[model samples]
Target: MKNQSLACAEFSESQIHALIHLLSDPDHHIAQTIHDQLVSIGHPALPLLGLAERNQENPILLDRLSSVIADIRFTDVEHAFQALTTSSTEEVNLEAGAFLIARTAYPDLEVQSYQRQIEDIANILKQRCEPGLAPRQAIQTINQHMFVELGFKGNIQDYYNPNNSFLHQVLDHRIGIPISLSVLYLLIAQRLNVPVVGVGMPGHFMVRLKAEPVFIDCFNQGVVLSEKDCAKFLDKYGVDFDSHYLDPVSNNQILARMIRNLVAIYQKRDESNLAEQFTRLLNIVEPRE
Candidate 1:
């Protein structure tokens, strides 16, 4: 493996500054070359790029710096994600996978801060979870805390917003699409020792208690549903219902699905570059057989 420090050390500070200054060149070819060079320099150039980005007044130059910074950040995310996928563990850490995926959109995301937020929420719910509480009653308590107190809701007004696919953004806004919301619920439930698992049903995502035949539609205010209700949802969406859809998914599958959501969104919006980025992540998570 090439040493990143050694590779970056080849470019003197002055040379890196010159390249950043040239990023706004009027000539497209010159600007493209500068961009490529900065990207190749990788993380070592980030401190300079970030400083330049903060002081930059020209919108074009600022955009170039931002792009380079995002590229550098994604390189790290890709390496970490690959390791997570290739590790020997049978069950990957779902929270870690989700946060890593979020880092793609928010390069500077505070992963530990968000983790602590989830932990705090779980702790509060744990106190409310009384001894000998029935599964359904416990779910009701969780639903109230999540939807009513915390104010998490389905982002129905702008369902296709890309932010809905990011874990940090979802936590910040308290609104997200099905899968992200279900992820939040699952994460908290896991901490509380609740017998809940993510249910990647067709066209919608939910969580089901392990001890009951009940499914909770996190996107819909945590409304409880039966297996038949899930089948109806599938039928309404023109998807053939299969029993396997209710099975718990691994962290790898969940991350792949999140990336798939972004890919489809970007494709629909004609943002080919963004779509390609997420598609690459999807392949990393669930590579072609």
Candidate 2:
């Protein structure tokens, strides 16, 4: 690991393989040194590490290879998230941000495939909808098509399953928590030219129209609610309701909330390392706000 800063091209193929095989060394210090060397080589070591993981019979060596690949991939994800959070544009694509978070868990996810799934759903619903439909009628159409026809519903039995928070998984399974469901609804609404926005309530997430005061609860069969009803629901939960909680949250704020949800889930499962990883991601997106 002496020439840690050297370009990956300087290291020959056999030299890198020698380092990878040395990962099975009995000495912990020696093995760690080899791991660090491979990591320092960065993305260039990925292909060899993947090959070693598949061909190697030793479980320990396989685990080490997997760790190295994850480290390198996570570094790339961090840089991508940083760039997304720091962009100058006011309108960030919510779907893009959600998929980026999903990539943390699924490094090889085909994003376009999932995008097409959502697009197909929108297209089917678009055929049913006519121009200049009423707000309530539009909400009813979406609810019927999404929940009743498509079989999307809340995962109340296993609410904390991490899949409930990931967009791709939610789309695949059609079951998710409030925030993820709201995100799916918002995205579909955007496609149909509906003026919907996310309402980041303290205990629950919902969606509503830009000019209307009614809230649509995507998790519960797209149930409609008035501002007074939302306030009373908050009171029932012993939470003091504030007007700002009903205000539309930006896409970045929604992504921050998603990260925070992951951190809480990992903490609950006693996965301290994963919790810390998501906490760092939260810092990158949420900032001090």
Candidate 3:
């Protein structure tokens, strides 16, 4: 438990300069020590960091800051944007070569569709869950009964199926992938009061559960497994997961994963622009501590 004062007591000019670049907006959500470390860096950066912190919840300020960052020439990336942004500082900068703002593909109104589906999933899960189940317990029950035992699969065709029930399609894997799992996890967790979030993994859409000491891969059905399992799963499919599964991911990393999943699928289907937009979203929903 290092205090801010202790943490930044000996920061050098280089450290401060380094932090300016590393202090990507997401880092501010982390602790005072990180904040202190930035403040300790040098007085020159303090005003900027202070101003940014002051406007933490201001959406306008956020957009402006994001714009400012977009303009800066990212040299070596200092500590890397992911370090300053997510609760877990493990995700690599997959967006380094990508664009800053992700374009909307589903139309603004369609965002509401995501919300509606979320509610529907919640109601269904509520019927199966005990009213007072703990977060982990509820997750376990859902996994055992629905995902694993029942073998829910996300077949691509269900995603395009018009007459099928979205809820039923999701349960049976007709909705395939990152979207279905993302919606499922969010809805079910809402019932249990767990704050688990989702991240769009590269080439895969996955969920991130807020567990002690780390976030987990819930898309694998409440397995709470690590990146090692990710690697193993890829190996089973003869895909080289090691090339990209380098470390445990952050919240943003997971979002990126989700976006990547969509992007890959879209790209495979030749929807170039949608792939680009999702790639941008991958950078947006990172989870910082």
Say which candidate scores most in TM-score. Answer: 2
The 0-to-1 C-alpha lDDT of every candidate, in the order given, reads 0.87, 0.87, 0.47
Model 2: colliding residue pairs: none
Clashes of 3: 22
Q: Against the hidden true structure, what lDDT does model 3 obtain? A: 0.47
> Quick one: how many clashes does candidate 2 have?
0
Task: Write one digit per residue (lDDT tens) for candidate 3, span 1-289.
Answer: 1443464566655666455445444544543234334433333445565466456776644544443332221211212333434435554333221112111331212234444655665666677787676666666666665566556555545443321223333543434454445555555575557656554444555555555222344444545656666677668777776533433345344444445555666778786645554554554454324
**TM-score for candidate 3, residues paired by index:** 0.40
Q: What is the C-alpha RMSD of each candidate to the true structure, in Å?
A: 2.2, 2.8, 14.9
Q: Which stretches of candidate 1 lie over 4 Å from their true place?
A: 1-3, 22-33, 57-60, 131-134
Error of 3 at 89 (Å): 16
Q: For model 3, where is the 10-residue window of minimal lDDT? A: 97-106
Candidate 2 least-lDDT 10 residues: 1-10
Kindly indicate the candidate among 1 and 3 with the higher TM-score: 1
**Model 3 misplacement above 4 A:** 1-103, 108-114, 124-134, 144-152, 156-174, 178-180, 195-209, 212-248, 264-289
